[model samples]
Target: MGLIFLGIGIAGTILPVLPGGPFYLVAAFCFTKSSERLDNWFKGTKVYDKYVEGFRQKRGMTRKEKIRINLIADFFIVLSLFIVDILFVQIIMVVLGLYKHYYFIKKIKTIKPGEIE
Candidate 1:
């Protein structure tokens, strides 16, 4: 699962359609839970440095990064809204989507580029 997300995240870095940041974070979590060795190995990789390390150190993201992540998340939320028939679930997803934006904008501090390093 970690590797799968890592691959997707790597591809996301290259491809515009996929959002790499969230997937990289997920991969880091999955690796941590799976094994210490795996976690350490992932942290040592350049992918982790490029995607996750800045967020970790600065505790925020650049405006461009935030926008990209939110747009991708919104896309999936809207896609799920069409697929899921349950009104309750749909509502929850909508709330989550809104909250996600709020959290990013309000809760997480937005930093300038090159601020992370």
Candidate 2:
């Protein structure tokens, strides 16, 4: 299960349509519960270490990071919506995508770099 989530997360990182962080986070949590060694390995990973740490420490991303993420998400969302031919569904997706971006930006802005709870 953990590996599955990790794989999905990695794939999501490459594919703009899928979400990455949530998958990685779920994998980490599952690893922590099922195997100490796997948890340790994940914690030691450079690519994922900081994200796990940030979540564990209850820290948030910097303002710049938030802005960058929002911009990227917005770009992908808009691009995908534009390419789709369905008008009503496309409009709904656009609204939902923007809402997701805004939600993350607002949630992440609450924590700055190094400001761990």
Please, what is the whole-model Cα lDDT of each candidate in the order they appear? 0.83, 0.73
Top candidate by lDDT: 1
Candidate 1 stretches greater than 4 Å from native: 1-36, 45-47, 114-116
Give candidate 1's error at residue 67 in angstroms.
Answer: 0.2
Q: CA shift at 33, candidate 2, in angstroms?
A: 1.1
Local accuracy of candidate 1 as per-residue lDDT tens digits, 1-117 = 999999998886654335577789999999999999999999999989877988888888889988987887787778878888999988888887787777778987899887635
* Residue-wise C-alpha lDDT for candidate 2, range 9-113, written one tens digit per residue: 888665455657778889988999999999888878874775556655675667766677567766877787878899987877777776667767665556656
* TM-score for each model: 0.65, 0.72
Q: Could you tell me how far off, in angstroms, the CA of residue 81 lies in candidate 2 after the best superposition?
A: 2.2
